[model samples]
Target chain A: MTLNRVMTVDDDRFDQLAYRRILKKTNAKIDLLPFQYATEALEYLKSPTRRPVDVILLDINMPRMDGFEFLEAAKTELENQIVIMVTTSMDPQDRSRAETFAPVRGYFSKPLTTDDISVIDRLVAQQ
Target chain B: MIDHDSNSRAHAPRSFAQSYATALATYVRDGNEENLSRAYDCARQALQSSISIGQLGELHFQAAQMLCSGSPSPSPETKRTEEFYLEAISVYDMALRGYGESVAQLTAEVLERKRAEQELRDVTYELARQRDSLDQKVKARTRELQAGLERSERLNSQLQQANQEQAQFTYAISHDLKSPINTIAMLLDIISVDHQEHLDSECLELIDAAQATASRMSRMITGILQYARLVGQEAEFETVSLDKLCRDVRDDLRQEITDGKAEIDISPLPDVRGMPSQLRSLLQNLLSNAIKFRDPGRPCRIAVSAAPKPRNCAAEITVSDTGIGIPEAYRTRIFSLFQRLHTYDEYSGSGIGLTLCQRIAGYHAGDIQVVSNEQGGSSFIVRLWINERERDNDTQSGDDG
Candidate 1:
């Protein structure tokens, strides 16, 4: 599938800034949508008037709704979108748990590098 | 009195018969009170001579017949003789009555004694049954206590396992914190490289300071993760040569040693039983600390030596350094986690090295003590067991971490 637009769900503002900067530096032809709360991200995915998101970068730890809770609450809305778990968790258990979700396609540590972006692009090409 | 052997008193019974007849004839002829009393005396004497009741009856019959034969018309005399015989026999009748009362009393005493014996047997049987019941109760209670102890032991083991898992979880969290700090440092680097021409020197210096602080925080987090990992994991033990281990540590810190103009003197040390990787970390931390905290006026000089405590099967290894010494008040506190004596501007460190060293020593069934040397330096004395048996003994005594 061709990459189009991406959404970021993270509680940390600096992490969002880092993502924006890295994505801008890469100059990839993709739209960026960022949400500080997983609840807001889930609502945006459910809205009919909202732009269709091709990829979702979900963080594990957040307020009100965690990444796993979001995956559960927006299961039907996220069927056409690929979810990539991006968080500051290096725990193998988190990776294994993310693998249980059908929408989750990849896992990466925080401050996604240029190399990580290329890997995501290649994952999209594979689909 | 009664005759003990009636058969041996046959001659005495014949004499008694003649005496009794004479007394009866006299009493009948005289009809006096004295003669009548004499007749009673003769019968009493015969009874006292151990004669049987049957022999006395024969003697009376013979006396009665003689009196009747002597008189032709002897009706009155015969009546008097019969009255005297009846009086004599009354004495025997009174004796028989007293003997019957004595026999009845003896029979009652024997029956009472038999009842008392039966009661004693019943009481003894009851006591034996109670004792057996008590023994069984005590045995059952002991078995219950043993089972309770075994259950508590199992719970204790499970609790220990849970605590280890919690420590592992803490380590993972600490490890995750490093990524964000790294990103901050990376972003600072990117800013400095990409936008240096647009920013002032002051802003660049501030960024540099922020980057430095972030790096220090990263190191401290790494130190915490290391300590947590050690707490959660168990290591395999092996025989370690201290002499070679010390040389290896010195080689690992070659750059720092050269920069500080440090000299390390190692003697022939003893072999100790411990985890090799942990021991290496222990020595590395000590040597690194010595180099980092050296006196500005003097070159760093460190000596590593060992002495065997044969009585305890232990080796006392000393690492003495000619560096800035620790104060007496902080000698014990230096081993606490995150306890620092100086700031990052003076000497940069995570402040967890000594704590790790102490933990490693405890893992080997040992302890570490610090003392100030005479030359204004510190000596770290570590006591480690020389063999596995000694270590096991120490561990059983609750000395290990």
Candidate 2:
């Protein structure tokens, strides 16, 4: 797939830093857009003049707005935005729940690794 | 004083009438008290013969006519005869009066008897009605008790569901707590790996310490999640062979066994009915602890054996090891969650292994206890209730293995 801009929504500062570091280490030719809250990410996606991203790396547990709530809002706001759940939660129920949403493409554990990035790249390519 | 002849003539009505005539004629001719007394005797005799009053009257009239037909002064004689007749009939009047009194008494008795019978019937009916009413009351009470039992059963089920939900909530919280620790450890690893050239040796050592602490916290959270998951889940029970299970656990801990050069001796074990995975976890934890707490000077010698306790339909499994024995004070506390007797530097563990073992034993309707061996070691005794049928099957298949 021709890689473009990718977005991340996470509440933890360290996890956000780890994701940036891991993505940078992967040496992927893609722009990174990070948000501290799912609500902010949903707002950005809903913006009229916002540049659309190819994939959204979403976190499940967050303050104020959770991943499921964001997915519910995004179903109507976006047409074909692929969301990949990268979360610290190892709960199978959360993974299954995220997969229930139409836009969700894949689920991964916390501290996104170079291998997980490759998996995401392949998922986006298939989509 | 009637003669025998007059008494015998009384048996015949015609003869009695002639005798009464003769007696009357004598009474009239002689005008004597003796003959008049005789005429009264004739009437008494007639009453004794059970003659009716009308028959006696006819006999008297005949006797009076006979006396009048032959007498010169018939009028006076006939008057006397009629007087005698009235006297004779007085005897019958007295008898009839006695009979009427008895008849009245009998009628009164009959009425009393009928009243008593009616009262008895009423009493019997009332008793029957009371019995039926009591039956209805008993049935209603039984229904009420049944309803109470059903309501209690429903409440008990709801309570069980609430407990399961609470366990699930605990599991969720533990899972959420684990993520941040894992993330922190990952971040520390990144720093230690990427910034090692620019950082001094002390800074790198501090990072290592931080990473170790984060790893320990992560392990603790994972342990809590596992314990909570055991409470929330309902696993199926099957026949589990402890001998095979021990071999599998040994294989799983092969790396640790090789590193410590631990000698594990497993005896033939009995089959029990339990959750296979939980039982495996329980044995694995015990084996892992035995290896982890081995004495530095001596070789680690671990032995596993089982014996049947027929009284309770259970098997007593003993896992004894030549390791650092627990003191008497901490023997009981070792089974409790997060109760550590050693520092992290001495022993690396989440301190939840024994707690998980205890929980798994409880799930199988069993219990586990620790005993300090006299030979400077520790032994864990687990009593697991086994199905009698499974035990029999195990006995039958004992020679096959």
* Docking category of candidate 2: incorrect
DockQ of 2: 0.01
Off by over 4 Å in 2: A1-127, B1-108, B115-119, B163-168, B190-213, B232-239, B254-262, B271-273, B292-300, B308-315, B322-355, B362-378, B387-401
Please state the error at residue B190 of candidate 1 in Å: 2.3
Q: Alpha carbon lDDT of residue B252, candidate 1?
A: 91
Writing each residue's lDDT as its tens digit, candidate 2 over A39-113 gives: 788888788978978788888766446789889877877578888888877888888888788888888888777
lDDT string, candidate 1, B221-300, tens digits: 98888888888877788898888998999999999989999998988888878877888888899888988889988878
Candidate 2 true-interface contact recovery: 0.00
lDDT of 2 by residue, B1-401 (tens): 24545666635786777777777877767776777777668878888877788998898877677668767764778777876777678878877888899899999999899999899999999999999999999999999999999999999999999989888998889888988888899999999999899999988987987888798788888888888888787879999998999999999999999998999999989898888888998999999999999999899999999874444446788999999898886787788776666545667787789999998987786778899886689999988874545445655433222
What stretches of model 1 exceed 4 Å from their correct place?
Answer: A1-127, B1-130, B133-137, B197-206, B308-311, B338-348, B386-401
